[model samples]
Target: MIHDIAMIPMIQTQADETQKRKWLQKALNYEIIGTYLQTELGHGTFIRGLETTAIYDPSTQEFIINSPTFSSMKWWPGCMGRSANCCILMAQLYSQGKKYGLHAFIVQLRRFDNHELLPGVTTGDIGPKLGVNSNDNGFCRFDNMRIPRENLLSKYSKIDPDGTYHPPISDKMVYAGMVLSRVNTVVWAAGHLSSGCTIAIRYSCVRRQTELLPGGEEPQIIDYQSQQLKLFPQLAAAYAFIFAAQNIHRRYDQIQSEVMVGDISSLQELHGLSAGMKAFSSLATNLGLEVLRLSCGGHGYSQASGFPRIYGGATALVTVEGEYSVLMLQTARYLVKCVAQAASGNILPHSIAYLTTEPESNCSAKSENDILDLEILVNAYRHRAHRLVNEAAEQLKACLLSGKPQHVSWNENHMVLIKAADAHCHYYTVMNFVQYLQSTEMSKPLRDVLTRLCQLYALYGIDNNAGDLLQDGYMSGEQISMVTNQVAALLVAIRPNAVALVDAFDIPDEMLGSILGRYDGNVYENLYKWAKESPLNQTEVHHSYDTYLKPLLHQSHMEAKL
Candidate 1:
């Protein structure tokens, strides 16, 4: 992940051509391992607030990097603990006695041949976490570490021999590289959510429990409506997120091409798009995995079921890239800008154009038949999102009008802003899901099943947000009950196809790492075999039994005899 997702992108986006030919080649050839080092103990999302300093020396033609305070030490960079020998580091720039803010630099962290930490650097792993123990997340502090000025990633920023700084052509391009990572995160996060969905769904189809009929053979748990309620919506979310991921990936490419040609107009739009995509996809998909895991009953709680590992990785997505709530606020800040632009009579970007025309006070799709119509479902999402965005906007305005400080007002209204951001992301997801289905042509069989999946996804979203949908008399209670019934019916309709649906994900068993989710439907036999392989089973009795259990039992017996 550090190599492909973070390292490669940094070099490709910011490294000079010569630096690229050297470092990029080494990265591609697997000759050098590296990770991104940016977030410090004191600051993460606020880049300008980072405390690490890099002061230039004109005589030596090098920069002295230091973590001046304990809180300034770099933290949470994956692979830096053990595997990585180098990193693209972010540090504050000082030259000609002027502070130039944050800039990226390529720093060799360890001696290449000996793999020993370089002079003036201290680094190591941060031990155990909730999940993803396999990854070596690490921390490092610099003690006036010196590097040649040439090591500066100068594609967008540069330094002159006399300790002068040259800024990027456009300020917006400074943030362009982050957009790529956020989009990649969207895809990576969705992949995990789907993995969990695939595991849970396949396991549900294979595992059998309670008998639904008197004296009849036990039935597969997939037949249970309650199980479907848990599994299908998550299954639907996996699909919705997949479509949303693809949409954002393609959109990133287009805006990236524009950035390459020096047109930075679309950069902010891309930033907001990628930020919200990463935030929402990671946050929602992680929750979806948890729901899917619980749906599997006792097995999901066991490490052997694979939720342990999958969820461990999924859980990190919310905090990395950017913390979910922080990114949502970033997204909401941009949305507020766009709303202001719309009110000024400017044309809005395609993604957010709906905000240009105010949402109707009441929903037109409250009826059962109209509710399921894909366009109406799309509009319903739009209405909820539009209202929430305006609500957040107006609330912020009210706070500002009440004479509070900007920072205080923002903090006071963050929850409302976060809700708006969430609603907007959900709207974008449903819109993308519907648009992808309509635009892409497929076999009728494939189309029919996807359409059903899409319907379930939309209705499930509406059902989940019934209160929001019903606000201002948009959707009535009777109609929401109908939505509940329809959700159940969709789950039943999706049951026969659940196995086939997850099968389409085409995840190999090796990647799944779960006996219960094996494709061959031999869960029980494999689970037994797996249990036998436990190290505790290697001995007839555990050593603790003799050292601890036997002594206690013997003591109890002597007392009883006395």
Candidate 2:
């Protein structure tokens, strides 16, 4: 919790030098266990709507924290149940009968010596989830909990002993934690999806299926066109996300340095980029992992295959940090603003300069062979994204022109907005992939392999969303068919190197935890050996057979005889 969530907000956003020293010293020394508490039973993404309150008591120089309603009870915070003794909590601040917006405060939750719950604090584990159960995610509540006035994280917003208040430099700056979390999630998703693809691809190469020549040897499944279609795109996505993740993380560090100097001009753009990448990466990784799992056929269902565990952990990533749809909408809002600015001749950020330039009107790909060019594929993506963003913006304008309220217009057209965001993110990822291919210095053989992967990635993206490309007039129906053919060709070209590609990831067999994905490819023998390790097989399962099954069988036989 200290390194993952609380450390940044606590030290960078609010804590003064003295406060930082004290907290850092304790945190470093393990004198205090810490967690970040923001999401409540009722509020997940809406931080301003949190019902927990922190009211100032100038007379005693303290802040009284309270969970006024059950919904205000903090839920889903890791380590709050039994590990963390302190939390950086978000609560509504009130002073001198005037309400202040949400603020952060340091609240001690458990006693240090005996690990007992502090008075007025209530917490416990939330119970089993889809996965990650070992982390001990917990729920929490507070009733009239009092802490010294200094406990309020005051680097950004502060209250004096005499009850005067100082506001933050920017209201948006307060959400630094969310931005950091989202950026980190993009990197995490890339690595996770890479691992999952590694396991599934290696297993596929070893797991043979289908004797096309009757009574002949069954071919390895990795040789099938359908299997290549399923797994190769995922392989491409892992590489694409890795490239994008590196750039996003680099930009995040730059933003942090800029923020330290009190320059927040780039904060909004950074937030939008991180939100979109997080949404895109999480959604893609979740879908891609599941596809990889199913590509292995029936064996993928077994826990011993390692797919279930990878999929379970990836599923939660979609909902946490930010809900997928909500974050997509956030990116859509930014795109809408960008479109409006561009129409008025305003300059756009370097990442979005394509919006200012006219979209490619002439068809770049005249035939199936022409469609294989990287520049042609990128142009199609840019044009489609341009049209989608403009269309969404126009929908909003029409709604506002018809006298609908702003919020109502946005809600009614949310579907259009989110689709625009999806297209924009796809365009960004494709461009990043293209740029990396052209600029990166690498061996000729590695470059050749990556070039095919990038082509597959781009063409597959087009094939999957052909309707968007067609509807925007960026590609003809015939052109899309060509894209599909190219995808197939690229898949076949990538088949021989599939095992080698996965091998390059170099994941340890112990870390993979899959009998099917063992390095030596002795799948059938390992499956048997691994099955014997199950607890159910420890004593030949005789206890259950004698205790219930035999008795039931005897009773049934007697009734049959009668």
Candidate with top lDDT is 1
Query: Residues 95-154, candidate 1, lDDT per residue (tens digit)?
Result: 988988788888898999999999998877777888877777777778889999988898
Look at candidate 2 and tell me the lDDT of residue 35: 73
Task: Provide the RMSD of all predictions against the true structure, rounded to 1 decimal.
Answer: 2.0, 2.3
- TM-score, candidate 2, is 0.94
- TM-score versus the correct structure, for each prediction: 0.96, 0.94
Q: Which candidate gets the maximum TM-score versus the true structure?
A: 1
- lDDT (0 to 1) per candidate: 0.83, 0.82
Candidate 1's displacement at residue 333, Å, is 0.3
Where is the poorest 10-residue window by lDDT in model 1? 68-77
